[model samples]
Target: MAPKVLVVLTSQDKFPANGNPTGWYLPEFAHPYEVLKDKTELVIASPNGGEAPLDPGSAKAFENDPISAKFLKENKSLWTNTQKLADILPRVAEFDAIFYVGGHGPMYDLHSDANSLVLIQEFAEAKKPIAAVCHGPTVLIKAKSTSGEPILSGASVTGFSNTEEDQAGLSSVMPFMLEDELTRVTGGRYVKAAQPWGEKVVVSKVAGSGSTLITGQNPASATGVGKEILKALGL
Candidate 1:
């Protein structure tokens, strides 16, 4: 049997207090999806089951990209019937790894959601390779080790930076600044690229666990994040 991966997305469609709409970032999921689909089986899920909104900007900008195009062309059950996080928990052990795709929506939904915490915990306990990019890494905020330490504590990680968030013009609107929260949680290293949108990928093997926890700084690092994750999994 092939390795299986569970991909989680945010259910949030509109920002709080009547802010602009958002969903999963296309490139972040596309690059990783295209990279791993041929080699591993993938299951797409959301905090809430069913349709997942796509970030209009990312969906529009990358509409013509081969991988993104393919995702749209093949609108199968995978696209329409996203399992709820709880529904998949029973079978979480079947997965060899897990992924989280980012968009502004994750800040509102995945960042502090309970279901996400459990899913992250299960994957970590199973010692699977877990990869998240951009704001997707936001979900790691709730993941804790067996000893109840933050999953990102002492682990080299990166996510959408405060500088990049400012570039996106969402510093004031986002619930809490992502990079700032990440840095606080890790209390170790939270590196980012010198340039806001530049690519940066960090892979850390948490001591005593042998599990690979990988993160990408932003959308530009999506493919790099995907590749590093596959490498960590020894593919």
Candidate 2:
């Protein structure tokens, strides 16, 4: 049987402070989905269970990318009818991995979501692969390992960088800068590409359980993150 991957997406559609629309980045989810869809069984899920929103800016920016364009046109139902994260927590064992897709949305919702934290912990305790990209790593900020240490402690990780955030002109709107938070939790091992928005994927082992934790620096690294997950899963 193909390995099953639980693809977690954000349901928050608007930024709280400005009410500017934000959701999962189109390329971040679409690019990775293209890489994993054929090799693994995937279940799309979100905090609230339905209608995971897409970041309109990402959609417009990457509209010309064939894979993302096709995914947007064909996979609407997957995002429109996501399984609730809480509902999937009980069946976490059924999945071989958990992937957190990113956008500004996660910084607001999944970062402090109780169910997301528990689910990540369960995956770590089970030594399952945990992957996240861009702002998705925000979810890991509050997650703890079985040993009670921050899940990212002593682990090399990468996510959307402060430079990229500022370049995107969302530095002020984001709840917290991903690079700073990830570095704090990882004890300064948070890595990134030499250049902003460049592709960078970091694969590390959870400190206690040795579960694979794969992360990407930005949307450009989404496919790399997916490939790393497949490698970790031995697929």
Candidate 3:
């Protein structure tokens, strides 16, 4: 049997004023879900529990793309039965790995969520690979391991860059930019692709730690991020 992987998503359903609702982008979450489900048992969890909204605009390509549509329909159950982040507390330790799916929602919600923070820390403490993409890496801003050290400290990682934020016309909208916060929290150099919306993923092994944290630049990096996670696990 394939290893069991917990895919954690943000449940924030509202967008900031004059902004778009931020949750998991359909392609970013669905593409990885499709690939990972084929080799592992997948479980979905979210911050506020229950349903996660998909950024409608981000679903544009998948709406016209047949393969993405089929994958979406096939995973309807997982989509419908998302476990609340709080509800998954006791069960987090059971997963082989954890993946945080990004959307604008994470920018507003993931940082202050203690349950989400703890779970990420739990995975880090266990030395399991933890993966995130796009805005998903926002969670790492405040995620401290059991030792109280921020997880990304001194670890090279990438996330939805400020350049991408500027390109998306959301530089002033988001509560905080992931690139700036990740760098501030860890004092580590956070890097990104020179261009916005490019596929740039960085996988770094936490200094002297067995766990590998992988992050992708934008929605475009979802599949590459997933592939890196698989490689990290030797799958």
Q: What lDDT score is found at residue 113 in candidate 3? A: 93
lDDT of 3 by residue, 1-235 (tens): 6787888877777777675555677777877876676787888888766777776666775687655687676866776668888888898777888898887888878767989898888888889898998888888888877777778888888888877788788787778778888878657678888777878999887544569989988878988988887887789
Judging by TM-score against the true structure, name the best candidate: 2
Clashes of each: 0, 0, 2
Candidate 2 residue runs with Cα over 4 Å from true position: none
Candidate 1 residues 1-235, lDDT tens each? Answer: 7688889988998888566788888888888887887888889999898988788888788887887777767754564679998889888888888899988888888888887888787778778888899999899987787778788878888999988888777788888888888898888588999888999999986534668998999988999988886787678
Candidate 2 local lDDT, 88-191, one digit each (tens):
98898899999999989999999999999999999999999999999999999999987789888899999999999989999998878899999998999999
Question: Mind sharing the TM-score for model 2?
Answer: 0.99
Clashes of 2: 0
Score each candidate by Cα lDDT: 0.84, 0.93, 0.80
Worst 10 residues of 2 by lDDT: 145-154
Clashing pairs in 2: none
Assess the local accuracy of residue 185 in candidate 2 as a C-alpha lDDT between 0 and 100.
88
Which residue runs does candidate 1 get wrong by more than 4 Å?
none
Alpha carbon lDDT of residue 170, candidate 3? 76
- Candidates' TM-scores? 0.94, 0.99, 0.92
